[model samples]
Target: MKAHRLLTVAVLVAATACGISPTDVQDRGNAPTTRIPPPSKTIYLLKDGRLVLEPADVDNDTVGSLLGALFDASTKPLGERDTALRGFTYIGIKDSLNPIQRDEVQLPRTSTLTVYIRGEGTLTDLGKAQIVCTAQQDAAFEQVRIVRENEDRPSRTEGRYTCGELK
Candidate 1:
């Protein structure tokens, strides 16, 4: 169980650090083979083994160690819910403008699942983002970007499709 937790952490680290995987150049379902609508919420993809948060790409906030670790597992099967938090972690805040965020709970072998939760309903300078997750495999990522929804905060995005934008 501890190892599983550790691996979960590893995935979170990988997500925030380098996105999710190498093949996901664009967001999932945005494939050339299968055409999908452009996502209103710009989420970071783990393509080519890297982390990316769009419409913008950068990490300028101070990530709390405990929060980072908590975020690492929040999308999985751990961490707090819509409570309230701040910092630089894959987990961001949700507000009235952008009240939704999603995270992927990676399950070995099986398909990935997405968890969707509402954010704090407001954006403060502290990066008090809303959006939490539940471990649900094979489910589609949410339809909210952590920041794009609110131009004020661009890094904020969600969806199980997100590897880890907390970067």
Candidate 2:
């Protein structure tokens, strides 16, 4: 009887150790899966006329997504004193636009990034510089450009300028 009792206790312990608990044995098909998105891209934001690179872990690698990360207000910069992009909305993705008469689109194109703004407002020169600098950080894009929808054109092109060059 003692040997039998010891064997039962050992079996129970081994089962529990093997993750055979009754609760854990229930079907887990509906259980929520916790997945963490890995950081795969770098972006630049503006603060005091200087560009700061920030790491972003996003599900999508589109131009608009990168812009969204750069403009996110909650992101903390490397330096406590650094600030993020002031005014910009991630509209969507697009390939073509009219320079004279533009409309809002998000995650537009790898070569050309379109921004959606609210009301009659637009991104300042410094803001555009921030966008350009941030977009260029991605290796996929060779000459990333910024186009503000229903807003004025940026003062400089992407390849020709840097965030530090902004004033």
Candidate 3:
């Protein structure tokens, strides 16, 4: 009985001697939650005459959809940055046949992404950079071709460009 009593006292003293003070439960607000982010694509915009890569929210990841988002004014540039793709409209992809003559032209492979646009005058180098970089965001596409559509026959090829060459 003496040994049992001494053991009980020792346990009590040891429990209280440990410098930990008991406190009430803490209410740290609600539990943490996790959510998946919306879909987004990388696009190139211009800042002070230089190319700046930016993320843009989009409903689809298609080249046309991505370019459409790039051209959208609502997708404002961050800070004092600007977009070279402004004032340019994206046209549908070129088909295998020439629209005028109905002659079969070489179809573009998956590695080549073509961007057709209808705009007045020529596009500046920065503007070309924006289109080329945005369209070639996927590594699957090795090159990007910009074709200018006009009322006349034989559309002008702006030139085939690679993101590496432009950047």
Instruction: For residues 38-148, write the lDDT of model 1, one tens digit per residue.
Output: 332323223333332322121322222222433443344312222233322343332222233346543333333222223445533113222322111113333223432
What would you estimate as the lDDT of candidate 1?
0.33
Query: Pick by lDDT: which candidate is best?
Result: 3
Runs with alpha carbons beyond 4 Å of true place in candidate 2:
1-40, 74-81, 96-110, 119-122, 139-145, 150-167
**Candidate No. with top TM-score:** 3
Clash counts per candidate, in order, are 30, 8, 0
**Residue 61 of model 3: what lDDT?**
72
lDDT of 3 by residue, 24-93 (tens): 9999999899964423477788777888877776777766777777777424546777876666777865
As a TM-score, model 2 comes out at 0.44
**Candidate 3 wrongly placed segments (more than 4 Å):** 1-40, 74-79, 94-110, 152-154
Better of 1 and 2 by lDDT: 2
What's each prediction's TM-score? 0.17, 0.44, 0.61
Question: Candidate 2 at residue 144, lDDT?
Answer: 39
For residue 132, what is the lDDT in candidate 3? 82
* Comparing 2 and 3 on lDDT, the stronger one: 3
